[model samples]
Target: MASEGSTPQQLSDDFTDLQKKLQVVIEARQRLDAQLSENQAVQKEFAELDDDANIYKLIGPTLIKQDKDEAVMNVDKRLDFIDKEIKRIEAQIAEYSENSEKKKAEIMRLQMEQQQQQQQQQQGPA
Candidate 1:
């Protein structure tokens, strides 16, 4: 629904707008991926620790002691949330990509038609 315009200029504008949106979605997906990786690393570290091992979290430049089980649970929740966000963004990216492709094809078709019209005009009375 984002790229319904049919005019050459309108189609070009829609394509540009979709590209910008795609870039933003990609950036967001990248950030979510980084967070997911970090959370997974933390989970791995937790797995390697003893049940009685001390766990600390940095809070505003201060080391705050946190229960290992609670920390693991929090990290698990964060990973799940990040995964969902990534999936949502990926869907948006796919939609935007499809729409952009359509707009590009329309623009090319319009250009070719214009060229054909010009050729016909030049050959007038011949």
Candidate 2:
């Protein structure tokens, strides 16, 4: 509940801030999710390569030849890091989602209270 002297304007501003924060979290989560999927696909591709197959990595404008085992190792390391980041981002999303719901509820409750006060004013001398 809003404390005494808390104007409707302040409450509205607070609600809007939460909305912006929620959107930012959602966008970040989406980006991490896409990256996670891409890394997983790369990991699968690396797994399918034969032991003797050659690998090339693009460095700037040049295609540099890389050892097959070395390429697999690099991809595997990236995959592990991406997996961890994905989990962390998911946890952040869950926490922000809960906060978003709570803020929305609080805004609703405040609006309802304001409406009641207005109604009471209009029904003066009751």
Best by TM-score: 1
Model 1 Cα lDDT, one tens digit per residue, 1-126 = 434446777777888999999999999999998898889999999999999999999999999999989999999999989989998999999999999898788888889999999999999967
Q: After superposition, how far is residue 62 of candidate 2 from its true place, in Å?
A: 1.3
Please give, for residues 1-126, the per-residue lDDT of candidate 2 as tens digits.
Answer: 356566768767776776787788778778877877887787788789887877799999999999988887887788788778777867877876777677677778878998999999999976
Instruction: Please report, in order, the local distance difference test score of every candidate based on alpha carbons.
Output: 0.89, 0.78
Which ten residues in a row are the worst by lDDT in model 1?
A: 1-10
> Compared to the true structure, candidate 2 yields what TM-score?
0.82
**Using lDDT as the measure, which candidate wins?**
1
**In model 2, which residue pairs have backbone atoms overlapping below 3 Å?**
none
